[model samples]
Target: MKLTREEITAALVGLLGADSVIVEPVRMDPYLREPRKRFHQPAAAIALPHDVPALQALARWANEHRVPLIPQGGNTGLVGGQVPLGENEVVVSLVRLDKVRALNAEAGHMTLEAGVVLETAQSLAADAGALFPLYLASQGSARIGGVLSSNAGGVQVLAYGNARELCLGVEAVLADGRLYQGLGSLRKDNTGYDLKDLLIGAEGTLGFITAATLKLFPMPQGHETALCSVNSPEAALALFYDMRRRAAGTLTAFEIIPAFGLDIQLRHRMLDRDPTAGPSPWYCLLEISRPAGGPEGTLMAALEAAFESGGVDDAVIAESLEERARMWAFREQMSECQSREGASIKHDVSVPIAAVPELIARGSEAAVNLLPGIRPCPFGHMGDGNIHFNFSQPVDADPKAFMAGAEPIHAAIYEIVVGLGGSVSAEHGIGQLKTGLLASVKDPVALQMMAAIKAALDPHGILNPGKLLPPSP
Candidate 1:
């Protein structure tokens, strides 16, 4: 027998103190709404567990009563993974669990609770004379738990790695209130099946990531940043090859941006001035990190070679730290600048590095054929093959109408992505938005395997129901 809403609230208040349970609808608003504003559903109550024991008790009670629980971090997830799906579920906000358990900077690792803000973690590493290379726009609010759950990838993924690669291990609470104490700082743990990797990208479907031990690196002495003009994506790719061949591991970031990106940033006054050298069809923002005793002018030497080979026409290397910041502002503001234009159809897809130019050409043509005058803004980590393919509505077009007819555009881009042996959803995991798409494209055997894993861990189907995995036929 299912409990009524009032009964559920009372039961929660009984378990945790009345102060920890929020029954007011207004107070529950923040936990229900996500970044994309796509998924909106009421939650029974917001449960605030102050410590691991409290969270474990809540999970055990939830399992017994079959109450669906949505584990949320700082509530900054792009997908609906961190929000509630229906009125029957309860959102477990982990903000109060913020704590720094251990920090061995010299040893290159630190253990932090799930609620520790990502930016705070970065500051902690810096204070210890080390570096945490995972940098994201949402790092100001995104927590370590959701970061690991989604396996987030940001600008530095080209050199360091994604959230999964940066994490050494995780400590989680299972569905039945048992603890999976897997946190460690070991560089080598050739043990049995790697449960750490399995839970890191599970998106809260497997368990609630309570804490984690993350990897750190030595701080770079300095950085070499530049924005270069490339005639086309092919030229950018050639330049990237030359840079990688020359700089090797020092080539930290290689981002590509179309001319339109710069235009809108300037038009909206998002930037004080144009950061590129001059107007060109495309631009590549490349950066190389200089070690403590490393030589400088590596980027300059590579650009000279690139210019002679006709891969680059013009370029502007940052002469000061302020110039470097402006160069990055141009790239980081790409997504925000598009919203000022109008409604945009976006696809976070990725293909092979060599096929990026082809992906952009074919995708732009396909979108234009379907909806003429559609502005395509394809830019992102070109070095890692993940392009944030987005299309803005035509001038003076109705936002609602444009969004209503977005099906064909989405279909066209995903089809091209799949045809080129690319992932339909890159970086961002298949939160409720792409479950159906994942079902259509994912291998059947792989889906079955995922289902088996879900059943083995969460038999009651209470941990983030109707997420990550597709519905049963």
Candidate 2:
């Protein structure tokens, strides 16, 4: 039998102390609202456990009562996975678990509790003369657990991999309150099944991550930053090919942007100044990390070759550290600047690296055909083929109307993405936002296997119900 909201609160208070439970609505608002503001389900209560054992007890109680629990970190997730799905659920904030359990710079790994903020982890690695490569805009607010849960990919994913690649192992609380002590710092441990990978991107539908052993890298001497003006996405793709050919491993970031994005930023006064070479419809921001003893100007030498070959029309290399920051600010501020315009439709999708040009060209044309004057601002990690395909509303159009017609616009763009062999959701996981879309596009057998795994791990379905996976038949 299901329990009432009062019963759920009573049971949780019985397991943990009454002081640990938060039933009042106003105080629970922050934990309920996600970064996207797309999901608005009210949770029955907000549970804050001070330690691992307390968290385990709450999970066990939640499981016995078949009550859903949404595990959250710093609550910076783009998707709605970190927030509650329905009134029956409870949001379990892990902020109290913040602690650096162990750090081994020589071993190139560190064990951190789930609630350790991503920026803090980076600081820890830097203090130890090492580097943690998972950099994101929300790093200041996003915690390790949510980062690994989403398998977030920032601009540097071109050099270092996503959160899953950066993470070695995780210590989590499984359904029914059993602790999963799978944290390992070994280079290679081929033990039975790789539970770490499964849990990393499961988006909390699988288990509640408590701590993690994350992989670190040797600090680079510096970086070579440049803003290249390409005629179009085709030219940008060609430039990326040349950069990859010359600077194979050191090529860390290759981002693409449109002049419209810069215009919006400048109009909104988001950037100090324009960072591009001049006025062009498109630009490619490329960078390469110079090793401790490696020669500098490697990127400069390659850019010279591309310019000679007519692949790049114009380019500006950063002459100082401040200049490099300015160039990156132009790229990083793309998403926020869009909000200055109006309600924008957003899609984070990825295609084959080679098909990126076709994806952008075809997608932009289709969106325009659907909604004339729909400002297309498709930009992101070009090297990895993930484009944050977004569209600002037509000038003076009602925001509500624009959002109401977003579904057809989404269909048009997604049709092109699927035709070119692209993923519907990349970097961002399938939260409540994309459950229907995932069910439509994913393979039937793969879906079944996922359901089986989820059922096996969480037979009670008390872990983040109605989030990543679709409802069982």
Best-fitting candidate, scored by TM-score: 1
Could you give me the TM-score of model 2 versus the true structure?
A: 0.98
lDDT of each: 0.93, 0.91
lDDT of 2 by residue, 1-473 (tens): 87889998988788778888899999999899887788777989999898999999998888888999999999888778889878878899988899899999989999999999999999999999999998898889999989998889999998888998898889999989999998889879986889999999999988999999999889999999999999999999999999999999999999999999989999999888887779998999999999899998899999999989999999999999999999999998898999989999999999999999898888888889989989999999999999999999999999999999999889888888888889999898888888888888888999999999999999989999888898767
RMSD of each: 0.9, 1.0
Please estimate how well model 1 matches the true structure, expressed as its whole-model Cα lDDT.
Answer: 0.93
Please provide TM-scores, in order, for all candidate models, with all chains considered together: 0.99, 0.98
Q: Candidate 2 overall Cα lDDT vs. reference? A: 0.91
Clashes of 2: 0
* Candidate 2: stretches off by over 4 Å: none
Over the stretch 1-473, how does candidate 1's per-residue lDDT look in tens digits? Answer: 88788988999998989999998988889888998788989989999999999999999999999999999998887778888888889999999889999999889999999999999999999999899999888899999999999999999898998999999999999999999999988889998999999998899999999999999999899999999999999999999999999999999999999999999999999999998999999999999998889999999999999889888999999999999999999999998999999998989999999999999999999999999988999999999999999999998999999999999999999999999999987888888888999999999999999999999999999999988999988
The CA lDDT at 64 in model 1 is 97
Off by over 4 Å in 1: none
